[model samples]
Target: MNLKSNYLLFLVFLMSLGCATNPFTGKQTMAIVSNDQLFPASFKQYDEFLKENKVVEGTEDAARITRVGQRIAKAAERYLNANGYEGYLKGYQWEYHLIEDKTKNAWCMPGGKIVFYTGILPVAQTDAGIAAIMGHEVAHALANHGQQRMSAAYIQQGIAIAGNVAITDDESRDLFNQYYGVGSTVGAMLPFSRSHEAEADRIGIILMAIAGYDPAVAPELWKRMESSNTPEFLSTHPSNSSRIAQLSALVANARAEAKKFGVTGFTE
Candidate 1:
């Protein structure tokens, strides 16, 4: 490689540097997008979505949703604060809403904006189940997983642009970009998403435990989720059976985590 190529490679490496850990998985990950840059974008999009959707208010489900969300948020704040991540959510504006849509999902954005669909309520089944999902989704936000994925995408885009400049043939550049997109989207992005799902499950278990929920119920909820047979990728969530198995395996440890948080008389 020539000096220019070497320098460019070094620049790319430097851009990949700044690190953050997954709060649940305890794994160091590349965090190219700063929280400062990510939160505003998430907040704006969340607000726009709320404006466009029918947000239900003053129902039993809505009340339960808010209560569960607040409990998990408190648990998250306590865990992060105790671990010296106090200011991580400093500018976060947390809000929760229940949407009347029948979609079988819930999501919490980076700045703590939450949306719950009506369809998910049946499978959620109980307060602990709702806490399970909230804990998992909020864990993703706190871990900055979305920001990490965005940063990785930007890096891949930069590489593709550079490759296109170097390759004179349009077909060759097209091929390069196509291969890059597939490799980055599937190889990197999908697996990264899967990692986030697993980490969130672990974190969610602990948060539920701390919030006085029987963490054991989390596995059963996942079992319900698995029975839903929702298409994984299009739906933007994990498979029910996979999550169920993972949660079941983590039960013993989840109970231990609950003990640390002084959770007693756990639901049987």
Candidate 2:
């Protein structure tokens, strides 16, 4: 078999063996790197980041970040347990920190180390809005989006290497590199990332609703994010319009889901 074909077969084999079911989505996903391995490494990296960055604390905003994160975490635990996936967070050591940064971004590391940037606070505007953002970031971790992204990166690199090995001519290789770079990234990786973002949005609204935050606020947050523009096809995340529309559509369903957990009222 050709080198490209060989790599394809190997990828198929890896996909067959390295799969984990996401409790939230009830879908099998790639997990070449287990949480046991990903978590410790992520924890160490998070610790190093904390040492390097100015982590905001001892203030209302900082406290709000932590409070919102804890509520989301509790909602996750409750959802998992109620859905027959108790102890799913066996190694999760959830930690939330507010960092002093101007970047409008927040992220949750693989094992639940979350950092909320100061810049995103203005956009969030309220405690419930903060919960909307927090839930989305946490959902990324819960759904193992990091693991899947890493697995996709591995596949991308492997395919590049296989193509290099199979194509010999200099001109052919240059053409291959030029096209492959854009094709793999725009076609394969960007769509994968956008899907993850949409999934996180879907799961997050439900989580925030269960945690007593109004899911309707979620689309508003995304509408605010629309000012930061990136074309949907080229960006790692779905377009702001797409996010707002999806979250808006899911709000009623999220509220209904929250009602199942006896959460009737939501903060706005």
Candidate 3:
């Protein structure tokens, strides 16, 4: 067989061997790096980050962060169990911390380690708003986005290596490197990230609703984010306007889903 055929077979094998099911979507997704490996490294990095940053503690805001995060986590477990994916969160060690940072951002690592920056509180505005943010961040972890991203990076690197090995001409290889880097990022990676964000948004609203927080608050939160000058194209997240519209459309369905979980009333 030719070298090109070997590379193609290797790529196919890699993809086939590194697949896991997304509990929420029930779809097969990339999982080149297993959670057993990813979670320990993620937990260590989270601990290191906390040691390097100021973590708010013993305050009302700090307590609220933990409270909302726990509720979202419970909602996730309920959803997963109800959908026949019991014990899906067996290895998850959930922890939430509010960091004393000016950046209006929050993130959840692979194994349920979460950090919320202080600057985002003004944007969150209320408990429901906080839940809106919390649910979205938590959904990312629940959906295995971090694992997929790492797997995708491995695939991207593998493709680059194959391209380099195939190109004998030095100048052609150099040109391929430059164009491939930009093209792959803009054409593939960005879109992959945006899809994750959107999936998180959809899952988040359902979680917030099940947790007894108004899913309607999600669109409002995005509206505020839009007013704060969030950009659109070539970004990792969806444009705020599109997010708002999507959330608005999903609010009724979220509420209905929550109703199935015995959560009929939502607090704003």
Candidate 4:
């Protein structure tokens, strides 16, 4: 077998071992970095971030952020327990904070540590809008998107290393770098990231609904995001227009899903 064939076989083996089933998607995803390894490190990083940043506390917005986060977490717990995923979050230590920042963003770390920037509050506007963003951020953690991203990065690196070893000519190597850089990133990686974003959106709307927040307002939050003007293909996130459309379509289904948990009369 040639070097290329050996590399191909090795990659296939790695992919097989890295696959794990995501309950939300009911599909296998890459998880080479296990929660046991990722969670502690993420928790430490989150602590360091809080220590270095101005975290708002004892205010109405900060209190709301925490309240919404707890509700979302409870919703996730209800879904997981009902779906035979009991103790799925056994190792998770959930924490939520509102950070003082002008950047319109929020994120959840690997083990349920979440932060909401103040700039996003204006876009969020109301309790339901905040729940929309909160649910999306928490969904990323619940789906283990962080571990999947790490695993994907490792795969991308391995492929690049294989190319370097198999191709001998320096000029050929330069061409390979050029094409592979664009092809692997735009063709493979960006799509992977975008899919995660969409999955988060789907899971998020459902969780918000289950938590007694109106899922219908999710599209409105994205509609507010549409002013950012980033194109879908080039960005890590799907276009705001695409997100809005998807959320609009998912609202009824999300509401129905919430009903299974005895959750009714969503609040707008």
* Candidate with maximal lDDT: 3
lDDT of 4 by residue, 67-95 (tens): 99999999999999999899988899999
Cα lDDT tens digits for candidate 3, 1-268: 9987799789878877768899888899999999999999999999999999999999999999999999999999999999999999989999999999999999999999999999999999998999999999999999999999999998999999889978999999999999999999989999999999999999999999999999999999988873435465578888877889999999999999999999998999
For each candidate, give its TM-score against the true structure: 0.87, 0.94, 0.95, 0.95
Q: State, as a TM-score between 0 and 1, how close model 1 is to the true structure.
A: 0.87
Ten contiguous residues minimizing lDDT sum, candidate 3? 225-234
**What's model 3's TM-score?**
0.95
Q: Lowest summed lDDT over 10 consecutive residues: which window, candidate 4?
A: 223-232
Model 3 alpha-carbon miss at residue 175, Å: 2.7
lDDT-best of 2 and 4: 4
Look at candidate 4 and give me any clashing residue pairs. none
| Tens-digit lDDT track of model 2 for 1-268 | 8767887788667766688899987899988878889999999999999999999989999999999999999999999999999989999999999999999999999999999999999999998999999999999999999999998888788778777877889899999999999999999999999999999999999999999999999999888874546778889888777778889999999999999999999999
Give the per-residue lDDT of model 1 (tens digit) for 20-124. Answer: 876655677777877788888889999899899999998999999999989888888877777777776787888999998988899999889899999899988
Q: Which of 1 and 4 is ahead in lDDT?
A: 4
Winner on TM-score (1 vs 2): 2
Model 1 spans > 4 angstroms off: 1-14, 169-174, 226-238
Question: What C-alpha lDDT, on a 0 to 100 scale, does residue 217 get in candidate 3?
Answer: 98
Better of 1 and 2 by lDDT: 2
